[model samples]
Target: MLEYLPILYSIFLVISLCSSIILLIPKVSLNYVRIHIGVLTLPPLVALLALIFHVDNIIWGPLHFNTLTWLMAVFVLTVGLIVQRFSVHFLVGDRSYRQYFSLLTLTTAAGSLAWLSDDLRLLLICWGTTLLGLTLTIRLKKEWQVAKKAASTMGRYFTISWFVLLAAILWLTQTTGYWQLSQVMTQDSLALLETWEKTCINLLLVISVLIPAGQWPFQRWILDSAVAPTPISAVMHAGIVNAGGILLTLFAPLFNGSIAQIPLLILASVSVLIGTGIMFVQVDYKRQLVGSTIAQMGFMLIQCALGAYIAAIIHAVLHGLFKSTLFLQAGSALHHDQPLKKSKKPASFIGKFSGIMFGILAAIGFWAASPEDAYQLISAIILGFSVSFAWMQLIVFGHGRIGRISGLILFIAGALVYGLVHTGFHHLLHETIGTGAQPSIPAFLCLMFILFIGSAIGLWLSRNRTSRGFTILYLWLVQLGEPNQAAVESHPKYLTQYMSQGGKKDEFSINIK
Candidate 1:
C-alpha cells in the first residue's frame, strides 16, 4: 500500500487523460459526463483510502499526513462530488456536455497531481495542463461573443501565469542547480546567496504564485472567465486557486530564513487586501464569487508565509467547499432566472448603528492581529475598513443610485482612513518615498482628501446615468481605464481601410489586405 500511492495517482492521471480523449469522440453520448465525473472522482478518493489503510507508513514519508493535507483532500473530494451532482442535472441533454466533462476530468487529474506531486517538473506540467483544461472549458459557452471574450481573457491570464512560473523555475534551476521539489525543499543554498539575489528570486516566485491565485492587476481574468459554465467556475475557484498554496507549502523549508519569509508575507498580505477590496465592488454574482475565491487564496498564501502550514491548508479546504457550494447555487439561480433575494424591510437605525459599531470593533481586532509596526498596522486597518465599506455599499446598491453613493462613500472613507494611518505612522509627508516606510500624517490626509474629491466627482457623474454604476466603480478601483474606448477610437478607420483594400472576410481576424 505504501509503495502504490504514487503509482495510484499516475494510473489515475493516465485514465483521466484517456477518458478526456474518449469524450471528444462524436459517438460518445452526454451520459459520458457522469462517467467522466466518476473517473475524476476516483483518484482523490482512492488516495485517501490508501492513506487510511496504510496510516503508519503514509505518516512516515516526506508527505506526512498532516491536518492540512488531509483537510484539503477531503475538501477536494467533497467539491468533486458536489460538482458531479450539479453537472448531472445542469448539463443533461446539453450538446457540449461531453466536452465539459472531459475538461473537468483533466482539471481534476491536474489538481490531484498538483496536490500529490513532490517533484517540481511534474508539478509544473500538471499546473500548465490544469490551466489549459480550464481555458478550453471557458471557451465552451454557447454564445460566441461571450465565449470569445472569455477565452481571450483566460488566454491572457493563463499565458502570464505560466510565463511567470517558467521564469521562476528557470531561476531556481540556475541558482540552486536543481529543479526537483524534494531537492529544493532540502537545499538551503538560497540563504547563501547575496541579499539582492535572494530578494530577486523570492520576488519572482511570489509573482509566479500570485498570478494564478488571481491577485490584482491580473484578477480581471478570473471575473471574465466566470462566464464559463457553473461547474467549471466552481472547480477553477476550489481546485485551481489552491495550486499556489500547495506549491508554497511544499517549499516550506526554503522560507525558514527571515529574509525569505518576510518579503513573501508582505506581498501575500497586500494581495489579500487587494483581492478582498475588489470582491466587495462586484455586482454580478459570478464575479463576486470569483473575487471571494481570489481573496481567500491570498489569505492562504499569507498563512503559508507565516509558517502556519496546517492553518493555510485547513482554510484552503474549507474555503473550497463553501465557495463551490455557493457557485453551484448561484449558477442554478442564474439558470432558473431567479435574481438574488433581497431583504424586504429596512434595518432600524439602532440595528444599523450596532452593525457599524461591530464593524469598527472587527477592524480593531484585525489591527491587533498584525505583526507590523504602528504605521503598517494603521495602514492595513484603514485599507481593510475601506474594502469592507466598499463591499457593503456594492451589495446594498446593486447597480443603482444607492450603490453609486455607497461606493463613493466607501472610496472616500478608504482614502481618508489610509491617509490617517499613513500620516500617524510616518512623520514625513508630501514626498512619495520609493521604499516601504511608516505611514505619515500628511500623506494620510492627502490621500483622504484626494479620494474624497474623486468620489464626489464619480457620484455626481453616476446620478441618473445610463451606464452601469457597479461597472464604473470597478473600473475606478481596478484602474482598467475605460471600456470600449479602443474600439471606438481605432476600429472604424482600420475597418474602412481594410475593406477598401479587399481584406479577409472574417470579422474576428485582422483584415490586412
Candidate 2:
C-alpha cells in the first residue's frame, strides 16, 4: 500500500492537469472548478498526516517520496488551491480569467512534481515546465505591453537558471556515472569527483538557485514581475521564490566543504541588506511584498549555507503562508494601511536599549539551553535579533500605553506560536535533512560578524538619515526597487479596451484630468 503512494500522488497531478484543461472551457462554471481544485488539495494534506508515523523514503522509478517531498507537496498544492479558489471570484470579469487558472494549475502541479523527482533529468523537466507555466501566466494580460515586457524579463532569467541547473546536473551525472539525484550524491559516487570538479558543480548550482530566488542582481526580474496579476504575484512570491532553499536542501551533500559556500554566503548577505532596504523604501504595496520575499529568500539561502536545511524548510513554509495571505488581501491593504501607520516617530533611546537587551537575553537563554549545537547558536542570534526588532517597532515605540501593552501580549503569543511550529517542523524534517554538512566554526563566526556589522551600519544610518551616506544609500535602494521603465505605465492598458467595449458615456467622456 505504501509503495503505491508515489503512483497515487502522480494520479493527483494528472487529475489536476486534466482539470486545468477543462477549466479552459468557456462554458464551465468557475464555481465548480474552484470547488474541485480546492477539494483536490485536501487529500494530499490528509495523506501527509498518515506519513507522520511512516518515516522511510519511498521510491518508484523516477519519483521519490520522503518527509521533505511530502512537506513541499503540501506547500505548493495548498497554496495553489487557495490562490485558484480566491481567483475564481477575485478575477471575475478580467479578460484572461480562464487562462489564469489554467496556467496557475499547470505551474503548481509541475512544481509539486519537481521536488518529488528522484532522477535529475525528471527534476529538470518538471521544474522547467513550472517556470514556463509561470512565465505564461505573467504574460496573460497581453493587452498590456508592460506586462509583456515583465514576462519577457522573467522568461529570460528563468531560461538561464533552468539551463544552468541542467548543465550542472549533466556535469555531475557525467562525473558520478548516475543520473539519479540520490545515487549521484552517494558517498562512493561523490568521492569519484576531484575537489575542483565538486567546487565547480556547486558554484553552477548556486548560480541557478540565485536567479530564481532573486538575490542581488537577479532580483530585478522579480521586481519587474510585480506587474503580474495579484494571484500570480502571490503564488510566485509565496511558493516559487522558496525554490532556492528547497533546491539547496536536496543537494546539501555537495557542499560538504566546497568553496562555493563563500560566494553563497556573501551574495546572500548582500541580497538580505538590499532586499531589506528595498522593502523599507518602497511604498507600493505589491512591490514592498516582493522586496520582503527577496529578503526572506536570502535568509533561507543563508540557512542553507549554514547547513541547517531543516530550518530553511521551516522558514520557507511559514514565510509562504504569511506572504500569500498578505498578497491575497493586498487589494484592501491600500485602504487598511492608514491605520497601521500611527507610530510615525522614531523609537526612543530607551526603546532601542530595551530591544537590544531583550535580544541579548534571548540569545543567552537559547545558548544556555543548547550549548553543544553550533547551528542552534547561530539560529538563536538571528532569531533573537528579529525578536528585538519586532519588539522595538511594535511594542516599545507605540504612542499609547494600551497599544504597547496590547502589542506586548501579541508578541509573547506570537513567540509561543512560533516555538510550537518550529518544534513541529524540526521533528518532521530533522531526520530527513541530515546534519552532515558542518562548517568551519571560525569562518562561520567571521561571516556572522560581518553580517552583524552590516546590520549595525544600517541601523546607525537609519538614525542619521540627513547624512550624505544615508541619502546615497536611500536613493540607491529606491532606484534598486524601481521596476524597469518598460514595465511601468501610468495605468493599465486594458482599461482603454474595456471602456471601448462597453462603458457609461459619462465615464468615457470624463475630463482627462
Candidate 3:
C-alpha cells in the first residue's frame, strides 16, 4: 500500500493536466469549470491521505514523497482550487478563459512535480516547466502592454536564476557524486571539500533562490508585474514565488554551518528593511502588497538562514494564505470610500516604549523555545518583528482595552505556536526528511543584534515623525522603486490601447482609487 503512493500521486497529476487540456476544446461549455475543479482536487486529497498515513520517503522513479513534499502539495492544491473558483466568476466572458485554466493546472502540476522529485536533474526540469507555465499565465492579458512588459521582465530575471540553478545542480552532482536529492546530504567530508567549491555552490544556490523570492535588488520585477490579472497575481504571490524559500529549505543540509549562509543572511536582512520601508510609501495598492510580500519573503529567508526550517515553512504557508486573500479582495477596497485626509500626531514616547517592550518579550519567548543547539538569533528577531506588528495593530489602529487584550492573546498564541512547531516539526522533519542545521551561536547573535537595532531605529523614526534626515532617507528609498516617467510614456495607453485594438472592456478590470 505504501509503495503505491508515488504512482497514485503521478496519476492524479496526469489527470489534472489532461482535464485542463480538455477544457481547451473549442467552445467548451463553461460548465466544464466545475469538472476541472474536481480534477484539481484529487492530488491534494491524495497528498492529505499520504500525510495521514504517515507516508514518507517514498521514491519511485524520479518522484519522491516526504513530509515536506506532501505538505507543500496540499498547499499548492488548496490555492489552485481558490484560483480556479475565483476565475470562474472573474473571467466569465473572456475568450481565453479555457487557456487560462489549462495553463493554471499545468503550472500546478509542474510545481508538484518539482516538490516531489528526488533526482536533482528532474527537479531542475520541473523548475523550468513551472517558470514557463507562469510566464504564459502572466501574459494572459495579451493586449495589455504592461502585462507584456511584466512577463518580459520576469522572464529576464528568471532566466538568470534558472542558469544559476542549473549550474549549481551540475556542480553539486559532480562534487558530491550524487544526482539524487537524498544522496547529496551523505557527503560528510565538508572539511575536505575545497573552500572555493563550497562557496561557489552555496552562493549559486542562494542567488538562485533570492531572485525569485523578490529579495531587494530583484523585487522591482515582481512589483512591476502588478500589470497581470488579479488571478495571476494571486498565484504568483501565493504559490510560484515560494519556490525560493522552498529551494532554500530543500537544500538545508548544504547551508548548515557554512559561510554561504552569511551572505544570504545579509542580503535577506537588507531586503526586509528596504521592502518594508518602500511598502510604507507606496501610493498604489497592488504595489504596496507586492512590497509587503518582498519583506515577508525576506523574513522567511532569515529563518532559513538561522536554521529554523520549520518556522520558515510556517511563515511561508501563513503568508501565502493571507497574501492571496488580500490580493483577491484588493479590488473591493477601491470600491469603498476613502478615509478623509487628516493630520495625525506621532505616537507618544510611552506608547513607543511599551511596543518595544512587547516586541522584546516576544523575542525572548521565541529564543527560549528554540532548539538548544539551533540558531536562535534570527528566530528571536523575527518573533520580535511579528510582535511589534501586532502592537502596531492594537495601539495604532485598534480602539481600547478589547483591542489590547486581543493583541496580547494573539502574541501569546503566536509564541506558543512557534514553540510547538519548532520542536515538533524539527523532530518530524529530521526523522522523515533528514534536513537540520545548527549554526554558530556567536555569529547568530551578531545577526540578531543588528536586526534588533534596526527595528529599534525604525520604531523611533515612526514615533518621532519629525526627523528630517530619516524622512529624506525614506523618500529616497521610495523613489528607487518609483516608475520612471519616460518609461510610462514609452508604452501605449494602458487599457485604452486594448480597446483601440478591437478588444472589449473587461468587467472585472480593477479600478484604482
lDDT of each: 0.61, 0.84, 0.78
**How much does candidate 3 score in TM-score?**
0.87
Which has the greatest TM-score? 2
Predicted structure 1: lDDT = 0.61
Provide the RMSD of all predictions against the true structure, rounded to 1 decimal: 12.1, 4.1, 4.1
lDDT for residue 231 in candidate 2, whole number 0-100? 88
Cα lDDT tens digits, model 3, 65-90, are: 88888888988878977888888878
Q: How well does candidate 3 match the true structure, expressed as C-alpha RMSD?
A: 4.1
Question: What is the lDDT for 10 in model 2?
Answer: 73
RMSD of 1: 12.1
Clashing residue pairs in all predictions, respectively, total 6, 0, 0
TM-score of each: 0.64, 0.92, 0.87
Q: Which candidate is the best by lDDT?
A: 2
Please give, for residues 24-99, the per-residue lDDT of candidate 2 as tens digits.
7767765556556665675466447536656358787897888888889888988888898787667776667668
Segments of candidate 3 deviating more than 4 angstroms? 188-192, 338-361, 370-374, 388-392, 395-430, 433-435, 463-467, 484-513
Local error of candidate 1 at 132, Å? 1.1
lDDT of 1 by residue, 1-513 (tens): 555664565577588679779878877654565677677676667666654554322332324333334434545655766786677767654546667767777776666655555556766787788888888887775344555576777777788878877786777767777665656645476655566765566667677777778775566666666656788788888877777776666655554343555545555555555555556666667766776776688668765654555445556666777788888888454555677777645544654554466457656765676555343344455545555555555434345677657766766686587457545422221121112223334433433454355456547655745667655656665543122221123332433555686755432232212
